[model samples]
Target: MHHAMRQPLPKPTPANLRRFAETPVARKAINTIKDQIAGMRWRIQRRDGNAPAATSDVRIHILAANLDAPNPDDSFRSLTEQVIEDVLVGGWGAVEVQLTSDPQRPLLLWPVDGATIRIYAGWSGDAEEPRYAQVTPWGRHVDLRNDELVYVRLNPRSHTPFGLGRLEVAFETISWLLGAQDYAARLASNTVVQYALWLAEMPPASYDKVISWWQNEIEGTGKVPIIANLPAKPEVLRFGEGSDRDLRLEWQRFLIRIIANAFDLPPLLLGLEQDVNRSTAGPLLEEAFRTAVVPTARLYAEHITREILGRRLGWNDLEFVFEDLEIFDERAQAEIDEILLRNDVLLPDEVRLRRSLPALPGGWGGLTYTQRQMLIGGQRSATGDQ
Candidate 1:
């Protein structure tokens, strides 16, 4: 069923955005984020109000396995990388959930190219209704309901059904960067000169001979040895004024910073390290993770929890999260954890979970250090009373 078409305004299409993403600085910035996100671990936790409760549900077990290996062709990391790349370039990521007959792994997730999926401008209030349609290889449209697919949009806006891509924001900058690089390449390849040869008051035959001789030997091959080179002495006429920076390096670096800003990254991540030092590097990296990586990972986690766990499997108690996603480095996080533990702000098990370590034996991790000390003192007091 089709409602009023959104009639997209003049903007960069997914193709154009992807083309720009392939450029040097953009690709580096995107890949850096993608690699970090993909490498992080995903966990399915039962939402027990901050308490870590182990789950015994078979469906949840199957889900964990399925997420580990989404399908035969893609692992969790590979699928995650593709989804993130699609979101960065096109502002959308799509995954079709396929159900299998096998009980061990009852579901598989296949990553769909966002370009093939079109979101309905008008969404029906019913959750079961189709809000998106996929254009097939045979040019047919297949409608997908909310639960059957996981569709994530980055930087969604009210004006349009589609999300706003980072590359789209930097489209003109990328175009300028590409143009400048192309011009510089042509200048280098063509061996551009600062001056031109002007044959002053020379015979037509001599001019033709000079032209022929230049084209044949000296044009692209550089200045050659000429004996006496006379008959009007072909004066050199300078064409343009010279500049200090000819390769447009400063312009390209400025454009790279713009691109980094569009992606909410620090310019240092994109190889603009002129302003960064050892003291500032950690802070810059932390800020980048806070601004760019954390939000992106949380967005994916939310979609997965809502669509896969809530809508499809009816597992309201479960939540999906990326492990160790804090912006703090290990040392900082360890210090924070130590402080929290010292102050009895968190239980040992909770800190262990954050560190991705297994719980201690005999459920000893559930109590705070002070609580354990008090319990041990009470036990000795009971022994004395006996």
Candidate 2:
């Protein structure tokens, strides 16, 4: 008989640790973070600082419609959600745009997994253009040019061309938190008890029989009460006098806060609402969106605008814009709108559109009244009152 030599196992690198950190439980947390970021409303707007068109321009409509319906089955919203998820987990998200026979129109927008797509910098004759190689399902590599792929990277490292995900930093803490949860669950399900059984002056055979009976009846079902014959007593003791479970719960919560901080998320956003109240919750929500969600949204917008809409489709002025968060005070917005309307900055129809109301009858809605007229009217009213 002959023995074959065994290959040595590979050392655990940062990439390997990152891959390991993407366990089922970790993936659930990542999804939650991504969902919160992607829940924001997004739209296509002109980069020339003009108002969004009443009727979308033909080029804008085609692009927006394609993004809204990336495929026959998927929408742009869902695609963006997944892209953010990938970017958070792997530090990059990429989408492939397939053009129609007419280069101006896009046929499909397909999301490519960041993990499967390998980016090779300086592969093309142009130093700025990075070549992409996507691994197909059949184990072959499909090369994609820069115009065909929209790649968004987060937190790129100094040396490596690739970006670094937050998971790489928080992996150990998240792993520990998940492990602690599993441990706590196990302890809750299978509580520990110290027991002492005493046999006083009992015969050897009878003692054995009693012990066997106790094992079968009491330990097996956990329903039967401990019973002993004459001169025998069974005592079940509590493991600890202190509240260890409470301490464990506190530790778990502390770990959760650490994980949230690593991802730049508010603990309240992750359902840890202990210290949050009406006053603090609003600020926390705003802070979370401003710090985390807004940056991610901006990254996506810039990449999509420059890569897909600007370069590929030749729509240089077309850009993606996320709607202002609805967390603002309606009263404040109304006051500002009124001022703008009086100053002739915004037409009546513009204000009406903002309020989701139909325009006034005929073209009267488009007329803008000046602040001078308002001031004159106020003077007349004051004189008439006197």
Candidate 3:
């Protein structure tokens, strides 16, 4: 009975919790796969630029694939196990790994002295090949039964390419949503605030207040106030005479209100109110089409993720943390995915997929629950957590 006593799990932190909460964008597309990001803790270690890249006291490394490494199905698992057992665990070294297949340094790992392991295993349905797996610290977990699992090393610089790029590829539909030119355009009309409220699916009383305000002011003098700031050079203009700054401003506000209402109304099940006039509604519709609404879409995605992971998945063995982060980058690479940098996993409002990343070859970035299910069939209950 000689075994390393199981290491203590990393406790949740404000930082950690944020990491598990999937981004609005991530939430939308990740649905293609099972999701799991609540219970894990992540380590985002890096070298300070001021300090030298290499020093006796500071040796920074991230897990990624080395093209030359063994294939996961053939001999790499044993190779990694040997490294984990003979090299890492034996000497007590800090570890970080990237779990993916690649042509260079196919499997890159440095045995670390940490007490945890992070595994990454995600496969698009088309890629039925065995996943490449790597390990980091602590020990491995037998519970992770995804045959399509492998660990690849990810340097900070190569992050966007691997994670975001893959995310973009896998969630092509959702990705398209954010990239839509119309979705990214911006319009700010305080009057649109009213419509915004309505679109947000507010109660009829809320809409009534807006309607009342509109009727009270414009109903009398046929005048409305400027509700929001516009560019010094507004792209839109009023062709009719008497459309002064005052009138234009009113139009803009009213338009914004309408746009807001359009935004607020979603789920498409409850239905929406459509009795708006051209003078009041035209701008609203126009501005909406012009503005990229990606942010709003992102906001909605975040809310949905919160509900699905925190509420539905919470009851199951799944837990997720939403982490906000700067994009990770490295020079020489066109995009960040294959770079030799760290911050890749430090997602901008990312949800760490596991209770924590794993140290085994399979725990590179870890798989979302769907990936887990595809690889291995069990999932946490959806009715257990509050």
Output the number of the TM-score-best candidate: 1
Cα lDDT tens digits, model 2, 12-102, are 3446544644764456457656776566656666775434354346776677677778876678778887788778776878888877784
Q: Which candidate comes out best when scored by lDDT?
A: 1
Candidate 2 accuracy as TM-score: 0.75
> Cα deviation of 276 in candidate 3 (Å)?
31
lDDT of 3 by residue, 32-115 (tens): 111112111222122231111111112112111221133444232333333222111111112233334542332343333222
What ranges in model 2 sit over 4 Å off?
Answer: 1-33, 36-39, 52-56, 102-105, 124-130, 136-138, 191-218, 223-247, 325-331, 339-386
Per-prediction CA RMSD (Å) = 6.0, 7.0, 27.6
lDDT order of candidates, best first? 1, 2, 3
Q: What's the lDDT for residue 254 in model 1?
A: 93
lDDT of 1 by residue, 1-386 (tens): 01112323335767678777887888988887888999997677777735446433566567788899989999999999999998888788889987788878877899999878987777776887898899975799999887778988999998888887777787877777777677667555656665777888877778777776667677656667363455687776865445525556788799888989998999999888997889999889889898888988899999989987787778888888888687358788888888988888888887766555677778778888898889999999999999
- TM-scores, each model vs. reference: 0.89, 0.75, 0.17
Prediction-by-prediction clash tally: 0, 0, 124
| Regions of candidate 1 where Cα sits further than 4 Å from its true position | 1-11, 50-52, 55-60, 101-103, 191-194, 220-223, 227-229, 240-244, 379-386
What C-alpha lDDT do the candidate models reach, one value each? 0.79, 0.68, 0.29
